[model samples]
Target chain A: MSNHAFIVYKKEIKDMVRDRRMLIAAFGFALLMPVMMGVLYLVSKDSEAEARNTMLALSNIHQAPGLVAFMEKREIDVVEFEGNIVPEELPGKADALLFLPDNYGEMIKQGKVVIGRLYVDENTKLGIQRGREIGSAMDAYSSYVAGIRLLARGVPAAVASPIITSSYDLGNAGFFRQFMGNMILMMMLMAPFVGGLVVAVDTLAGERERHSMQPLLAQPVTARSVILGKLAMVSTFSIVSSLLSVTTLLIAISFIPAGTLPFAVYVNAHTVPLIFIQLIPFSILIAATQLFISIQVKSYKEGQSYISMFMMVPMFVSYLKIFGGEKLADFALFAPILAEMESLGSLFFTGEVSVSHMTSSILVSIIGILVLTWFTSRKLQSEVMLDAA
Target chain B: MIIVKDVAKAYGDVQAVKSVSFHADDAKITTLLGANGSGKTTTLRAISGLLHMDAGSVTVDGMIVADDPVKAQASLGVFPDSFGLYTRLTTREHLAYFGEFHGLSGTKLDAAITEVDKMLNLSEILDRRTEGFSQGQRMKVALARAILHRPSNIVLDEPTRGLDVMNIRLLRTILFDLRKEGRCVLLSSHVMAEVSALSDHVVMMAEGVVCAEGSPAELIARAGEVNLEEAFVKLTGQEDNGERKVA
Candidate 1:
């Protein structure tokens, strides 16, 4: 930084510190995404515990004693229902209800299969768990009956089932990492943008609106120096905010009950610095682009409105990695927000950080910063922007 | 010394300033006297290098403002019309910022701040934020910022516009003191009394053109008017109500 630029930076920092409303607004934005993630963790934790201990309401239990025995052995507690007709809607008396027909015994005697009705909302967590439990128990009881029938015909019971199937998960990180990783991606994408917002607008449009631009510009300082000073100030604040946000989120994730989730929830110590390094170019890009747009507008309010509208572009782009998933094109690695999102996903989920993908993303962001810096410096020199004050 | 030669500026078809020129000599006070829309502000902006001229050039202390704006700006201390103070900064911080921007640092920067504070009688409010500042208080900080670097030339755009009697007198004393120190001081004003009292040289503008240029007495003699105000009205060809003739 030039001497003049440093002077301006120092003054701006002090000025920003004294501005209560702006500080509060900035602090609020910093906390927004992390707080949202914390709330999500709490809600998911409650439902997960409920799913572990599912309850079932079984009707006409005497007709399917064998099926009832299987459910009970699996630690699924049952409440008996003795009505001749099953209720249309399962009364909210239990998580889910199983309705066995009076003809269930007759069907079994005739060597026929009987389909028992399972009533559940399927939307609630407990309801879904109960439904899965009843379905698995029914499958088990039917297979046992088939084995007995096969032995009675003078055939080996093993002939009925020659193959046994099981699944092996290939991923080391559980859905916990992927789920939290997505949230972290969104927060990282927004961090630079939200952090630099007020400072960028204040240095450009705010100065213009307050009629301070003329005197400030009239100094011996070069236009480029002025621009650099403002950009440096904004970028510093953005990087700090991003670091704080990610650290807070990581700490919050650590508090989550590890046993409740299928995968462990923890962030590696080295990952924090790597994430911050990835954000450096993004912070500079956001600072430059925001300042460029801000200097064109006439007032702080006008700049804010334009910037807020422009933010939707990056915001929508960030979500492409989530919704598009693996279906995204190979060239997505060279895109701006999409590339960052993909890199973040890989880093957290697979614990695999692709140097090629990250390098391309950083290079693109740096190019964006250069282009915006050119325009912003030009704006500072332009008589139109100066005279507007 | 600052010289603006035949500078013209136009905003599309409006032509805000046309064929304006003036010289502010060392150790003297020069004023641009004009009515509203007569281009006083535009002329000042053009000379300050804030507005690029459509034609001609501005030379500050021997450097052309157009060719080397930074070097030219280094010699100028400018107080623009309707200047804004950063409401969140203390008065001393404002001065220190300008001082450092002008390349002063260390003890020199601190000394400059102290000097400006003393010169402007800003000690009482030096540590306070500028929010809710009175007009006079704001002017004090703005003027201090303007002169903190102690440039060879000082330019003020209607510095006394909103000042009360005491504040106006204080500004008058400061301008006189600055001139006594051999610095060229230039200001723009429409108030005839202030122009007559403080200006060693007056450039009277009308409709974006210099209608007259001379000392106050010389302008009075040239217009054959008894007073400077009457001379100003006669030279600009305006009625007492400040309206111009159809021609």
Candidate 2:
């Protein structure tokens, strides 16, 4: 049985290799993630530059000299706006704006709550970070004023604040590493899902549509073996392409200008194999399910459309794991698609993947591969899948 | 020999093959002459174990297809109506793939490819990919792949549907050679001239069952017609030289 499957595998791989153009295209798409990572690094570096010299358009700076001094001390460039400048119009006009309402100094003396609007274009990374810095600086100024008020009332500054709260992050990885973790893992997850899509669909539905599957099925091999052969070929391509993409990402990460980020973003030799290992089972699952859906479709075009749409499922799962910053329920760790992504995240940020999480992920992926392969094999044997029959 | 006995199949509400039965003997070519949707492909599929029959049995070389489809398939070469050629694979590669599929390997696989290549005059195109191959070239590669393993039985569906006169003649010679080697060659075709010229036994099917089974001469006599074409139209209840009613 295995021998026949290997024969099928050899033929499929040969066919795929002969269609080098399609493979090259898939590889190109896989390389996009690494390319995107490089682009993001450049953008982040630019944003870092923007943060150091944050330029905020101030409409009423004369009313808040103390706030102006604090802004200058923090290296925030205070630019004078001569006309009415709206925060919503800040996209191409200015990075951010600080609007101090009229009578702001009188309200401070009267101890009335004064709402100073800090308008920022949240769309840009620099605008968001600079806005955060200005808010914290406002807090520092308010506390400094509170200390003076307490001294006038014959009280020590410690009377106003009893306890100082600070958090100790257990994870020692730098900000860039944590930030790139999602983007990198997202890229890794996408590598197999996107890379293996064409091969998986073409080997089955495309072959059937071209009338080649009939002769293939007529051979002395079992249907299960044929399915296995196709699955093995597609999974191998996906895994290899994902590994290459991961390697490319690592190399790309290494080329990132050192100190461009506050945190170090490194993909060591250990992480490379670990990332590849985490991605393999997911690749197998993707290949199997792709073939499963492709077999059910009538033609290559139909299969392509359906597989492209179906690819969004894994991507959605990966994105959810990346963006859903909340702690996940324990049961979620066993979910096949999300588990691999989360385990990869653990490996990157925490430097140690939880044993239970890894086991669950591996188990779910293996089980998913088996179940999908079984269904695909059953479909391959059915006459509905064999148009020539 | 390939024997199909009372094989009946239905797809949803449509009864495709209702009690179809026939036997193709060794060392002879059997032709299934039918119009469109006459269950010719369905019967072949049943014999190849590609489709399970609702009722009845099919056996290839004493092995029941349902019980031992792999073993039965090993002894039979099926060239479906569609040529089913991989455009990217060269003619030699196509032969090697099927040769390996039938358990041929190493020198045995290489020798089989060379022999089939010589017999089919595929030497000129063996190294060329099949993407731009003509219909005749595609048919030759598909046929060579089917027979590379020297199966005892060969089932071909619509083998001469789109062939030029020269290619048809070449196919005739190949079919004769297979028969002479004691291989059972069962084929389905709509072309009466080729059927009458090549088939030693003709199975006339109409509306999912065998309407008549005999030599071309016998069928012509049974229909009281001068030629096999009129006989086929008459046996299937369709008027000659008129629009064929949809089955």
Candidate 3:
């Protein structure tokens, strides 16, 4: 690189440091990730606790003794009533209402099961789901009750059962950790949009808007040098934000008591380096993508809009993964945001990643960076930068 | 010295410059006179290696600039019509930036800075950032940067477009000094007075082609006009003094 290239790079970095808005935006993004993760963790923890302690209102109290006994045994607080449950009294009164018809026991006794109704508001879905778990326990108890009655009449209980089976998870130690890790990794992928957007926009589009790009482009330096310099600055901010987000997540998980749930939520010291290694390429790809968008637009606002649209792609991909539980294939590992999520998910939950998968994911990310850099360089070569739109 | 041999540039279907040819010798100011969209700026950009010519070549100091732009551009200084300045950089830093591009560093960089600053009369605002500079100040700073490396050839496109009358005179004086230094200075302007006053050689362009070329007095005498502007209008066969009417 020539001194001109270095001067360009130094000038870009200096400008970024001087601009209060860009600095705040970068730090704001870093701070935002931790705060968001912390807020989400708090919300999830609170909801889980609330769900476990939820109370249910029961109607038609006299219909089933086994279910009542099962609820008491499981420490489920149930209030029995004779009529319809009032919606107005639900808040602070019960988490949900279970309406058992008068003929429910009769239907079951006659070997004809009837469907039970659960009345719940939107806010009570989690609690209601937990409350409904009592029904499963009741089913086992009712079968036991029927077997006892059969024994009283000298019939074998085993003859009344069709089959018996037990379930055991075949997943490894890191399975649960990997699942939680995927969520963290997804959050890290999102860091680039939050962290890299402001810097990238300010570097290219902002310069153009300020009318400073012409002199820079006209300098004796090559376009590649300019792009590399800007990309370096953007990636620096992105990596910082990603690391901060991961640290905040790990700290939040540490506050949770051990053995509280199925998944290992804590961030282990051993995994930090590996996670960082995996994340660097992901951040590079995201930074390059945002830079490409910045280069295409004319002003900072347009660059911001372009980056916002680009950000939606990764977010939508993450949403699909979370809600759809899409299975990852070899080919899917080459997809940008999806690949990051999958690799991270595997790294966290399974603690074992196939070498081929890791190689392909990194390859795809590097390829994305290369393609975006090429595009930005090409734009730098155009008269569009010199010609105001 | 600079040489243009049958240079042409196009944008898709529109040909901006059509088989244009001219030569600019050292120790003289060569001004390109034309109406709006007459390919003056396009020709200057082509010579600066900023635009690719569809046909022909631009050679600066015997080095082909357009075909191998990096090498070609290294030997020339270009001051665009509406150049941008880094708002945060002090005038000295701006000069230093361009000076470094031409590989001037250490004592050499310092000497270049001192010389350009003294010549451009930018010593007053050398330490202050350029964020608050007036149009004329900015233009002076840009000119200083263009000549910081003391390149063999200098190409300026409408360098005095927005300057005040006093600054315009100052710029003309500087151009004269550059000509005396035996450096090839190619300037494009619509202002016929400045062109007539400073140019030793004038090339009149019309519709992407050079219609006339000679000394200012010679062109004026040949076109049977007393002033350069009348000679330009006569040579190009266009009226309307190239001025914008305020509403």
* Winning model by DockQ: 2
**DockQ for each model:** 0.79, 0.80, 0.47
Instruction: For residues A93-134, write the lDDT of model 3, one tens digit per residue.
Output: 566677887788898677565666766654533554555565
What does candidate 2's lDDT look like per residue over B1-247, in tens digits? 9998999999998999998888999999999998888899999998988897899999899999999888899999999888888888888888888898788999999889888888899988999999999999999998998899999999999998789999999999999999999999999998888999999999998778888889999999999999999898877776564434565
Predictions in order: chain A TM-score = 0.87, 0.82, 0.81
Candidate 1 Cα outliers beyond 4 Å, as residue runs: A29-34, A46-54, A73-77, A82-95, A124-133, A136-140, A143-177, A257-266, A387-389, B239-243
lDDT of 3 at B214: 97
Name the 10 consecutive residues with the lowest summed lDDT in model 3 chain B. B238-247
| Model 3 steric clash pairs | A174-A349, A177-A348, A177-A349, A178-A348, A178-A349, A179-A349
TM-scores of all candidate predictions against the true structure: 0.92, 0.88, 0.87
Please write out the lDDT profile of model 3 over residues B69-115, one tens digit for every residue.
77877778889877588787888888877787778888999998899
**lDDT tens digits, residue span A201-305, model 1:** 888999998988889888888888888888888888777777777777676667666775444433586666677778788778888888999989988898999
CAPRI-style docking class of model 1 based on DockQ: medium
Q: Give all candidates' CA lDDT scores.
A: 0.81, 0.82, 0.77
Clashes of 3: 6
Off by over 4 Å in 3: A1-4, A47-54, A59-70, A80-125, A144-181, A209-211, A251-262, A265-269, A327-330, A350-354, B240-247
